[model samples]
Target: MTYQAKLIAGGKIVIPAELRKALGFQTGDSLVLEREGDSIVIKTYAQVVREVQKEFRTMVGEGYSVDQFLAERRADWGEE
Candidate 1:
């Protein structure tokens, strides 16, 4: 569904309340905006983190353990 939004003063665009409710957005929540070509993509912070994690997992291939990696890094830094 497309909702019309107004660009208020100070270049702030108010997202529609219905859309916000649908997306589970709340007051003072952080949003990530990305410019892809000529379109602006708005995503929640968690959504962006999940996307990054998915990409990282694909790049690292299978059998990658984040806990093990962190332990190794801590060992290198002489930390328990």
Candidate 2:
């Protein structure tokens, strides 16, 4: 669904009530704005986190412990 919103003072735009309700957004909810090519994308924080977690779950790699990863990064830093 698409909706048109006018840019208010200070370049702020308000999300339509219907759209917000459909997306289950409350007054205090947070949204993230990201730039993609020539378009700006907006998504709720929860939505972004869910997408990231889903992507992480699908990733496959050699099994490594936190200590191992940290040690490797520290070595790269070279005796900072």
Candidate 3:
């Protein structure tokens, strides 16, 4: 769905109602914006967190505790 929106004053662009509904956005929701090769990508905070977790999961794998991993690293560094 392509919707053209105008850049309003104070650099605020109003997201269309239909687009907001499709994206499951609501009032007072936080959004993250990324600049990718001349394009802007908008995502919800939860979506960004999931993406980050996915990237980290490849290194940590499933059923691995990040806290435990960090503690081991700290032990190796003689910090704990």
Q: Which prediction has the highest TM-score against the true structure?
A: 3
| Total clashes for model 2 | 0
Worst 10 residues of 2 by lDDT: 56-65
Best by lDDT: 3
**lDDT tens digits, residue span 1-64, model 2:** 7898889999998989998899898898899999999988888999999987667656733465
Better of 1 and 2 by lDDT: 1
Write the candidate numbers in order of decreasing TM-score. 3, 1, 2
- Kindly give the stretch of ten consecutive residues in candidate 1 with the minimal lDDT sum: 59-68
Q: CA lDDT, every prediction? A: 0.91, 0.83, 0.92
lDDT of 3 by residue, 4-79 (tens): 8899899999999999999998888889999999999999999999999998989888878979899999999999
Error of 2 at 53 (Å): 0.5
All candidates: TM-score: 0.79, 0.67, 0.82
Q: Give the alpha carbon lDDT tens digit for every residue of 1-80 in model 1.
A: 88999999999999999999999888888899999999999999999999998898898876788897899999999998
State how far residue 36 of model 3 sits from its true place (Å). 1.3
- Winner on TM-score between 2 and 3 is 3
RMSD of each: 2.4, 4.3, 1.9
